[model samples]
Target: MIDNIRENNAFEADATRDEDTMENKFLTFHLGQEDYGIEIRHVTEIIGVQKITDVPDMPDYIKGVINLRGKVIPVMDVRARFKLPPRAYDDRTCIIVVQYNGTAVGLVVDEVSEVANIARDQIEPPPRTSRGKSSRFFSGMGKMGDEVKILLDVERLLYDEERLSAGLVDQA
Candidate 1:
């Protein structure tokens, strides 16, 4: 009975450690000159920017769709989504594919940085007075050294009610 109790205690300790680790893990990427991060759990894959077929009647940010492994996935330009000026896609441009609401969506970012483990204490809630399309996209800010990574809320960024008003949901 004592051995079983010890094993159970060890299992609980490991589980707690794993949960803590997961909470801090994020996949950091770049959009323009700023760094952003999304929880690692939402990231499905990262692929090079490929040919995106333009779809009409959609928002400018919605660059259109890409054929990814026999699946058509909608791609959004992170810069345009934030109302930033457009820049030509270069070698560093990448598509970070994420699964939100059971649908695969591709986010076009300037480049992918690296996975960062930002402790919970380092994250601050989004500023209440910040107003704009981009402001609603961030869930929090994570501090790493002197840099701040805008942590994106994947659901809010991709599947929010604003997307419905933009006519992306009905067309998709």
Candidate 2:
């Protein structure tokens, strides 16, 4: 019984350590003046703002599809998706490719920041208010030094019902 108890404790410790490592790593990015982050595990790659073929009848935020190395992937303008004012794509603008539910999507942001190790203790739950269209996008708020980073939930961001309305998902 003693040996069995010791083995169980050791397994639990290892599992806790693994979760801690994953919880602290995030890929930070920018939209306008605000900073945002998403779990690094969800990010596949980052690419420059390339030529996007516009798909009619979709939401404005769904900019269009891009041929990423022969694979056609849909792209979304983070600013427009959040109901922010539109801005011209400049040199700093880039796309962050994230995979959710086996599908890859490009998120267009003002610029890519850096990968940050924000501890779980530094993150706070988002406010419970229906303030803006963008509010639903943030999973949590992380405080880093004197700044705050809005942490995004990639699954919610990609698979929201709005995506279905945009014709990205077929109704069953």
Candidate 3:
């Protein structure tokens, strides 16, 4: 029994170490022509676009909620949230379930790409656009070879009080 306990503890420690190493990784996805990324730590799972029950009195971007396993998760249309032109959901349309600020929200994206390792040095601050209008959504721009992925600040995306309401307020 003692030996088994020690082995289990060692395995748990190794899993913790693996998570620590994932801090520099980003899960890349796309909206339209542009690619975007969010910290891998925030992502829990990726699922196909599910039926979203409409919730009235909410923002247009807030499509509604979906039953994910036994949990009901709120879904948001990334395109609508960014004020992009709406498109029909195809096989490529999927939801990126992310846990941020203790809430699990499903981000409806165009498609998921791949998980890329973006070191701290490879990330640059977002450019200053007049009054930082578009910069608020980005944490930084991650450069990968010749391509750039706009790294999103998940907390800011999900928890901003002025931008979001109906119990999805910022906890921190």
Which segments of model 1 are wrong by more than 4 Å? 1-21, 162-172
* Per-prediction TM-score: 0.81, 0.81, 0.85
lDDT of each: 0.89, 0.89, 0.89
The residue-level lDDT of candidate 3 at 20 comes to 90
Model 2 gets an lDDT of 0.89
Candidates sorted by TM-score, best first: 3, 2, 1
Clashing pairs in 1: none
List per-candidate RMSD values in Å.
5.9, 6.4, 4.0
Residue-by-residue lDDT tens digits, candidate 3, 1-172: 9999999999999999989988889999999899999999999999998789999999888999999988998999988888889999999999999998799999999999999999999999988665534456789999999999999999778766555456553232
Q: 67-99 in candidate 1: lDDT tens per residue?
A: 999999999998998898898999999999998
Among all windows of 10 consecutive residues in model 3, the one with the lowest summed lDDT is 163-172
In angstroms, the error of model 2 at 50 is 0.6
